[model samples]
Target: MSTTTPDRSYEALSYEWGQPPNGDFQIHLNNGHSVDITENLAAALRDLRHQDPSLAPRPLWADGICINQKDMEERQDQVAMMSDIYRQATRVITYMGTESDNSTGAIAAMELYCEWWNNNGASSRVEMGSFTHEETIAIQKLLSRGWKLLLMCGRRTLAHWSLLSDFVVHIFDGDLKEGGFLLLPQSSHGTDTRAECIYQLALLRHKVQGRTISEECKLSWLLCDFQVFAATQISDKVYSLMSVATDVNIPIDYARSARSVYLDAAKKILANADDFTILHHSFPSQGQYLPSWVPDWSKWHYGTEFVVRCGHLCPSGSTRPSVRVGELENKIDLKGLLVGTVTFLGTPINDHYQRSSNAGERAQWVQQELESIKAHLNGTDPSLLMAECLVGADVFLDVRQRSTIGEGFVAHMKQPEAIIDDVERSLVNSFVTAVRRRSRYSRLAVISGDYVANVPRGTMKGDWVGMMNGGKHLYVLRKTSTEGEFTYVGISYVSGLMQGEILASDSPSEGRWLTLV
Candidate 1:
C-alpha cells in the first residue's frame, strides 16, 4: 500500500471532498474496522465499485479512506507523497460525481468536439455554426463541471486525466473523449464561448506539437493559476500543489499558519526563479499579517487577470536580480532604479467599461477615457500611446492594428452617434477586446515625466514607480515612515518605458537597494 512501492499497481482517485453532510457514511475496511466518510467520497466509492465487473474489487488509493486524517503526522507524511502516488499509479480516475443537468449529453458532445478537433487538426479554426444549439449547451455544462473539478485538483493533475491518461468519467454512464476538451468554462467571471473555443484550439495546438503536460508545471505558474481554488484548510492551497510543481521544495508542516506557509512559498520562489514575475503575483492582503512582497494565496482578489503574455516586456532588461533578505523579519532588499512617480489617475478601465449599459454608452465612455488620456500627452501622439498603454504593449496586436484602433477611438469621439464603416467597426471591436485584456484591478495613471501607465487600483498620486532588477514590469512602491524603506504597492504597466529604455540608459552600478516591507 506504500506509494513508494514501484512494483504495485493501483488506480488513484482524484476528487473533491465536498462539505461533510448532516451524517457521515461508514465503510468497513478489510480489517473489519468501520470508518466514517463524507457523503461525496462515499458516493464516489459506490460508483467506482460498479465500474467494469471484471475490474471490480481492484486495489485503489482514495485519500479519504487510505490516509488517517485524525493523525496530523500521518496526514503530513501522506500529503507529501501525493504527487508521486498519482503519477506512479496505473491510472488516475477522476470521479465527477453522478450525472445531472444532461451530463450524459455533455459527455457525448465533448466526444464529438474531440472527434472534430482530431479530424480538422489544431491549425484549423472551429466554426460555431458547426455545432447545434443543444450541443453548445451540453458542451458548456461539461466545461463548467470540469472547471469546478480543476479548482480542487491542480490543473497539472487534471490535465493528465483529460489529455494523457484519458480517465475523466461521470458516475452513471457515457465516457469522456480521450484528449478531452481543455477549454475555459462559461462563467460569470467574464469568459464566453468564443474565448473557450480559442483556449481549446490553443491546447490542441500544444498537443499537436508534442509538448508534455509536465513541461508547463512550474510552481510559480501553478500558484498563480490555482490561487482561486477552494481549500478548507488554507495551507493546503500551497501544499496540495507541491506534488505537481517542479521548482518548489518547501517542507510540509500542517502546524504552520496559512500566512507562514504562503510567505515561505513566496520567498522560496523569488530566490529560486530567474524572473521576478512572482512579485507581481502578490495582491493586497485580506486581514492577513504578511509582507507586501509575499502573495496571500488564501484570499481571492476579484478581477485579477493572469498576465502570462507580459513576460516579453522587460523594463529592466537582461538585469539579474540583486536581492538579499534584510535584517528586519519580513523585509527584503531589491536593487533597482526609480522609474518615476504617479501624478494623475484615471478611472479603472474595467470598472469604467462595466458601468455602461449599452454599446452607445460604452462607446461614449471609451471616447471620454481616450480624450482624458490625450490631454495628458506632453509631446507623444495620443493615439499611439493610448493604444500601447491599454493593452500593456501586447505583441498579439501589431503596430498597424493598434494605430487603427486608436484612430477609431478618435473618430468615435468626434461623432458619437454616426454609423461607422466596416473597417472602422472592426477596429472598434479590437479596442473592446484590448480593454478586456486589462485587469479589472488596474487603473490608468500618469506618472512623472508625463509617462502613462496601467497601475494597480488604489495607487496614490505620490507613489513611486520602480523598475526592479529581474522584473518583467514596473512596480509601484509607497514610501514607508522609515526614511529608507518602502511598502510594495502593486505591479504597474508604464507605456514607452517597457522596452528596456531606462535600463539601457543607466548603469547597473547606479541602481539603489530598495528595502520593501
Candidate 2:
C-alpha cells in the first residue's frame, strides 16, 4: 500500500511495530523486500507530523511522543527498543534540534537519540569520536536496516561531518534539498565546533558526487597542506552548493567562505594519497621483492610487509576526525613469493583408510622434515636472514589460504533451524587458533603458514598490522583483540610441517622438495 503524508507520498506494505526504544522493527514490503527502523530517537514528533494519503494508511511510530516516556512501564518497555524504531521508519525525519534527549549540554544535542549498546559497557552511550568496532558495527547495522535519514537543517546542529555518512539521509535546506551542516563557534557550548561543521559540509559535497575520501575533518591550513589532504569521494552538489549558496531564497555565503579551504584540503589529500609515506622501515631484508623490485631488490622466500597510516590532519579546531584504511594489492609480478593455490581438497586429510603413504608413514616423514628446517634456522648466524625467511613463510601462508579471507558481515544472520553451523565454525576457529599458538616452536611441524591481520576495528585502517612469520606466530607486536584481529592459517605441504595443518591433502608434485616414489 502506498502511504502519503501531507508533504510526501511513500509506498509501504507491511512493517512490524517492535517492543520499543531499541528492538527490531522490520518492514516487509508487498514486493518481498524489507529493512529495519529504529524504535527510539532523541526528539519527539510534536512538530514532526505527516498525513496518510493511502486509503488504508499505516500508522507512524515515534518513540518520544508515541510511547509516553512519562509512563515508567511504557518508558522502560519502549526505551530499550532503538533497533525497532529506526527499522520501522520507512524514512527518518531528523528535526534539527539543539540536543539529544538523553544527554545534557550543547554537544549532546547532535547525538542520534537511542539507548546505546556498549560492547565493553564502558558506558551505555557514547558520542561518535574515533573509529571503534562497536561504532562500525552500529553503523553497519543501521545500513543493513535501511533507514534513509531526512536531515533538517537548523542553525545549531554542530556535529562533525563524518557522522553524516550514516546520520543525514537527505539534507533539507529548510527550503530545498541543499541543506548542510550548521556553523558553530571555535568552541561551542555543546560538543559543537565550526571545524566539524565545515569538515562535514565538505564531505557530503564529495560523497554525493560519487568521489571517495580517505579521511574527514580537516583543519584550515596553507594551500600546500590542503593539496596533500584531499578526500577520496566527490559530491555532485559541490558545484551546486557553491552556485546556489548566495540565492536569496536560500542564502549560504558563509559556506562560500569554506570553499577555498575545502578545495585546498582536497588537493592536499589527493597529493599525499598518490605518494605512499613510509611510517616504519623494515631491514630491506624483511620485505618481499616483487617483479618491479626484482633482480635489483634482492629476493628470498618472503619480504617485509609494509605498514602505512591512512589519515589527514583534522582541519584545525575540529575535535572529532576519522579516516578509512584498507589493504590495496600492489601491481607487481612474482618475486621471492610463490603463488600458493587451494580448492576443496577431496580428501581434506590423508585418511586412516587410503593413506598417501603407509599408516604411520605420514607422521614419521613430517617429523623428520621439521627437524631439518629447525636445524637450518639454528645454523643461521644473523637475525636478518631469520626475519626475511619468517616473512617469506608468512607470504606463503597468505597466498595459500586465500579462501579464509573472510568478509565479516557474511555470517551475521541467524539460521533458525540450523543447529550445527555455529559449532562447526567454532571448531574451525579453534583448530586455526591452535595452529597459530604452536607456530613459534622451532621443533614444531609447520603444516600451514600463518599470519595475523590486525585491523584497528571500526576504521578500515591499515593503521597497525602485526604479521607473524615462521608458520603462525602472533608475534609480540599485538596486544588486544578489540583491535579487530583475525588469525590466518595457510594450508601448505604437510610433509615439511603437518603441525600447521589439522587437515591436508596433496597430489604428488615434483618441485618444492618432496621426492615421492
Candidate 3:
C-alpha cells in the first residue's frame, strides 16, 4: 500500500463465510480483529446457551443492535465486526419483516438490495470509496499504517452492475425509521428508499463537487440550455412537486389534456436522461407577465421572513429546509411599509398600514444591486427575500386577525434591516456560491415558482418539501465542451432512476407509483 491510502481503492474482496478451520464461519476485520459469525446467528447462540446456560447473552453485533442510529458512532467503530458478525453463526435467522427499513426492524433486505450481499456464506476483501475528501486524505495517510478498505456503498450497485436496464438498491440505510419492534433476528419498519436515495444522492454530490477536469470545459451553456428546453417537450417531465398528503392538485379529466401537453413540452426540453434543474431566479418585471406580488425596497428586509414562512432556517441557526439567513436578525428603525387597511377586534375601527403594496417589490433593490456589480471575479451578490403569510390546508388562511392593527393603532414596520453579502456568505458554503455567483443566474434573486415559470399556481401555498442541506431543489446541468458530458448541481434527484423504480410503498388506488417533487 502507498504511504497514503489511495484516494480510492480498487482491491477485489470476495466473501467466503463458510471457512471451517476453527468453526462454522469466519470474518476478518479491517482492524485486524478476527471473529466468527457462524452458520446461523440465533440457532448458534441458542446452542451455545444450551451447552452452557450462562453462555446465552445476545451479541450486540447481532443484526438486532448493529443498525441502531443511537449507536451510530459505535457503529462506525465496529464496522470491522460485520464480517465476523455474519460469518460465525451456525443458524443465522433471516428476518424479512419490513423490506424497506433499516436493520433494527429489518428481517431481510429488499430484493433490489445489492448483490455484494447475495452470497450467504463468503468472505473476501473489497475496494471502496473514501468516506469523504478529508477521509480520502486521511486514508491515504494511513495507507502505510495498514488501514484496510472493507466497505463502500455504491461500488457494488451502480459501478458494479451498470448493465441492468434498471436497478434500485433499497432498504439498507439505517435511518428514516418508522415505529417497530424487535423479535427473531431483530427488525423494524423503515423506508427502503432512504439508503439508495441517500446513496445515489451522496454520489451525485461527490461527483459534482470533485475538481473539474479542464479538458471538458468547452461546451458553451447555450447548447445545454437548448437541450434542456427541448427535453421538456418529451413524453413526461417532472414539475416541482408539493409533498402535502391531502387534496393535492391532481389533474382532472378535462384538465389532463392541457396539463399533459404542457408537461410533455417541459419533458422534451429536459429528457436528456441526466439530472437537470429549474431556475429559482427572481427578477423584476421585464416581460409582459408580472408576478402576483413584487418586493418593496422602502426598507431593508431581514431573512426571518423565510425562517417562519418556509422554515428555511431553524431557531438554532442550523439550515435544513431553510435557505435564507438573517430571517430573525432585528433592525428596529420602525421603517416604511405598504398601505393597507385592517379592522381591530371588536373595536369597530380600521387603521392604515405602512408595508409595501406588493409582496415581491423587494427584488427591485437586489436587481439594482446586481446590475451595479463590476464583475469582480464573481458576478453578483445576493439578498434575502422575505414574506410572512398564514396559509391553510386546502385553502388560504383568512388574513383578518393577522393583518389587523391594534385597536386602530398603526404599527410602523420595525423589521430588521437587510444586510448585503456575496452569494458566498450564506450559511451553506456549498450552495449560492456556484449557483448564484458562478453561473448564468448570478444576477437574480430567489424568485417564487409562479414568477419563474409564469404559472398561475404561484398563489397556491402548498407545503414545500425543502432540503435539509440548505440546498435548493434547483439543479443546473452544464455540459463540458470537451467530453460532451454534463455537470450539475441543486437538482432534486440526479438520475432518471429513483427509489420508486424498485418498489412503491403507496396504495395503487391513490396515485402514480412514484412522485417527483
lDDT of 2 by residue, 299-409 (tens): 111101211111221111111112223232211111011212221111112121120224244334333433444454454232222122212233323443323322111
Per-model TM against the reference: 0.82, 0.20, 0.17
lDDT of each: 0.68, 0.27, 0.23
- In candidate 2 the C-alpha lDDT for residue 268 amounts to 33
**How would you encode candidate 3's per-residue C-alpha lDDT over 1-517 as one tens digit per residue?**
2212334222222221222234555555578975655343333333323344576443323432233324545543333344343344333332211111232111112222234435531343222321223432322222111101112121122233221111122122111111110111111212221222223434433443463644231111122112221121121111111111111222212223433433332233233212122122222221222121111111111221111121121211122221121222210011111111111101000011112122133234323333432132143221111111101100111234223222111111212244424331222112211111122111121222211100111111221212222222222222235342222212221111111221133222222111121
Candidate 1 regions off by >4 Å?
A: 5-7, 51-56, 113-140, 146-188, 191-218, 244-247, 285-287, 300-305, 352-357, 378-381, 398-423
Candidate number with the higher lDDT (1 or 3): 1
Give the range of the ten consecutive residues with the poorest summed lDDT in model 3. 344-353
Best-performing candidate as measured by TM-score: 1
In model 1, pairs of residues that clash are none
Q: Where does model 3 exceed 4 Å of error?
A: 1-245, 252-440, 444-517
Q: What is the C-alpha RMSD of each candidate to the true structure, in Å?
A: 6.3, 23.6, 25.6
What TM-score should be assigned to candidate 3? Answer: 0.17
Ranking by TM-score: 1, 2, 3
